[model samples]
Target chain A: MSTTKYFAPSVEYAAKILIYLSRYKSKQSTLTEISKNLDINKSACLRVLKTLEANNFVYYNSETKKYSLGTYISVLGKRVGENLDYLRIINQFLEEVCELTGLTAALVQRVSFDRVMFISQYQTQIQPRLSISVGNRFPLTEVSYGKWILANVSEEERNYHLREGLKKVTSYTRTNLQKYIDELSEIKRSNILVSRQEYTNNVTAISSALYDWKGQILGMIALVGVSSLIDEAEEQRLCTVLKEVTNRCNEHLIQLKIEAYEFPYESKITQ
Target chain B: MSTTKYFAPSVEYAAKILIYLSRYKSKQSTLTEISKNLDINKSACLRVLKTLEANNFVYYNSETKKYSLGTYISVLGKRVGENLDYLRIINQFLEEVCELTGLTAALVQRVSFDRVMFISQYQTQIQPRLSISVGNRFPLTEVSYGKWILANVSEEERNYHLREGLKKVTSYTRTNLQKYIDELSEIKRSNILVSRQEYTNNVTAISSALYDWKGQILGMIALVGVSSLIDEAEEQRLCTVLKEVTNRCNEHLIQLKIEAYEFPYESKITQ
Candidate 1:
């Protein structure tokens, strides 16, 4: 099998096992299930799981003979420390957004090329309210949280990012390449990104980018709720609250910036 | 070179590199610096860093020739999922404890054999307060949080855990093995663990094991502050608050159990 240079297949496979178990449908996946789904040999899969288990990167249940992501990931992630205070501040803002708009709000940070993870979330008392899981991921090219990040990058960067076809998440999602790029540019101009049944069919979300005092993109502040409760005019009002909170957050978060980006996500792509 | 069964040296080294960069005294580490510190060959170090960067497990700053932990760790950890609500509950209790005691409070979770990771922390308006980073680790066999968890385990399990020599973290720390085991047994009776300038000088911490409704130890809830502010009476009062908050938390967190515990941390040791 051909692999990229500098990529160790064993190590990559180990990491994949971890990422896979975190998203596994069940709380744990058996060796046979993992090997089959992840396309690895059974022995190699066991070996990888064993190594992960040894390091507490994954836990194995002897009775079920299944594997799950370990607490070590959370421990290591927390040690990525500089942004702790920033996340706390974002969480407080999320609470206010949820409170003011009678909806749920979340702070979404880009996790990878294809995913943005929720760092913090707040739920309102509004009946039939919806809330996203804190550590769950959304597609970068699909969800408004992900698209806000995608839209802010330069054209060259955006092209390199979406070199692969944009996978449609829902029927309402824009699929045409030119149209998608055009929409991203439009969102950038408006400085408010919205998704109505684009990511999940019943949810409506409006998001805006957070910037530090130095003009660096920190993450995205999103106001999310049940689609039935939010409308065009209401979304516009929530955007106002989001902007105010983000502006206040920018003042406090200026010093807590995680300056290391994805090396411009392919420093080569940028060049 | 001989390596333990199921342990991939390269994957282990890559994880080590990520952990190292996180705790590195400096903001970033150069290839030579990491190689020299971690005792890996320069070529191997370069290869690991490159692979980690490609996977966004590490970030490479070409201009500075430095490496730092990547955002993937945080993202993946968040996706671990089951503990998110529990962590949020813990954070709330911490805030309440901190508010009541006029001290800093933290929730600590066992992350490994020898360490517990901070899950949440809050500081009050009291002057000269102390706090720890949420993701930072403390030795399980040394500090109050670790000792609390250690105390609950069977003596056989405890002995198996620290088969290796326990390193002294501070001058006042108990270093004698027999004395350590005896002290652990004694502390279990009192149900409160205190570190009087043991882990770090001038910081006093008193902790109690936070348990779920099932009576399994979830983690430790600690009330910490400058030693000057915490007298014998204050410590007692704070413990009351800590227990009350943890009890309230247990009610909310009963449904959020992280059931995937390490499969008998000493399976090999038992053999």
Candidate 2:
């Protein structure tokens, strides 16, 4: 997957149109509107939108001459939920964590080299609880999952990532280089990372890394709650439950030997 | 949304790539395999794929030199679920139907001019039950929802749609034009559609249309079970429950006046 100078500007604009529609999904947008807002030529926007509508990625309302996100989006989402075995399995564990701890539990997977995303979540029914939704993304150095990743990687690589230093997300965020590195060392030893109001103010999160059969980091199981509702004792108790669940999850992953599962679609790039 | 001869070939190919990845989501595919399978020019495919990867619509695994569906797919899916107000409300009603009748409940929405997709479903826990997933699409002339749709439309339009006749999905499928029209007329009077083994073998379904405050056809609420488990008496009972629920749902929609809800993002296309 070497970086290539060749690019498809039409495809890029098409993606932009889809994302713009996603933000205003409840409303319909006309081609001219999309073109002006996205700053693409009107003719080009129409072509892209028509191609998308032809594929059911966007729904065009003929009566009103407007477009919205289409049913294919739901279909793709369903595929993501069903085809990913690990996501399916982790969702059940997330539900259990939400029920047991009365806190929002989320499964965050590394989506790219520098981003981790919440792919699944079970919100607690408890009042004044923290809420997290699937698809929320954070930078690799900005969340508890990032802490786990940084702790587990080679020291050289970790240092390379840390060269920019951490941004202060909240008042409690650890931006000091020495202190943050010390915390990463502790995370490496304990396999658990806890932060209060570091990502979002008034929220405390307890996160632990999960591994697959190959001993590769798969994702992070994070439990979060309102800081006002969690005292020191409650945090400790919730942390224990979270650790136990992640440990069980990792053990189950090893027993399943999931990494060895066949991927029949490999087409080697000869280039 | 006038039909246009103009098309963006690159955008179309990009969509095809994403859909292909969706089918083989658990595995990664090499650029060559994607190009060969999709018959897209190798260079063109690489450019589109690189654009997709840059946008997080596809993830490139550097070590394996392969690509898979990316996190943006999940994000777009999340947008569909969260932004569609009716889908969210109907989901709760579907859950109730599942609990009340111990049958799989689903919400079907018209997607395109001639297609309807299963956008939401709640599978039954009962043994020997049917299972349905979101995104399963069918022609508007086939399923129970189609029955409601056909019945609701003008006679001339309905006759035109009926001219081709229905396909024989099973021995019980109604293929005779007149007989199908008669059944649709019955549905018109009762506002309910009952189908057994018409879409799939051994599956019995009862569906009714839901309406917004404007009385337009919103979608269908369907309850399905194994035909063997649903005798004539059981079917009648289930029909009654389905009708009652849909009526309640309609009343709720009217009260909410959901269509009156503001869509702040409407930018009209001034030709």
* Top DockQ hit: 2
Which residue pairs clash in candidate 1? A135-B78
Clashing pairs in 2: none
Candidate 1 chain B: worst-modelled 10 consecutive residues by lDDT: B262-271
Residue-pair clashes per prediction, in order, are 1, 0
Model 1, B1-271: lDDT tens per residue?
1234655767767766766776737438889999998988888777777767655566555555777776566666765545344555677778887888888887787765557777667887677877677667776776767777777777777887678857788887877888777777876676577788888888888887766545667688888878877788987787777777766776776655533344355554432
Tens-digit lDDT track for model 1 on A119-211? 667887778878777667766776667777777677777777788968778887777889887887887677677788887887888887777
Q: Which ten residues in a row have the lowest lDDT in candidate 2 chain B?
A: B262-271
Best by the TM-score measure: 2
Tell me the TM-score of model 1: 0.66
What TM-score does candidate 2 reach? 0.72
Which lDDT tens digits does candidate 2 get at residues A1-271? 2334667989989888877777744346888888988899998888898778766687665445777776577677677665545566777889998899999999887655566777778986688777776666678788868887777666766786688888888888878889888898898678788888987888888998888777767788999888888999998999899999989888886775544211111111221
Per-residue lDDT tens digits of candidate 2, residues B1-271?
2334567989989988887777743346899889999999999999999888766677665446777776567778877766655556788889888888999999887655566778788876687767886766678787768877777666766776677788887888878888888888888679888788887888888898887677667788999888888888988889888888888888886775544211111111110
- The superposed Cα distance between candidate 2 and the true structure at residue B59, in angstroms, equals 5.1
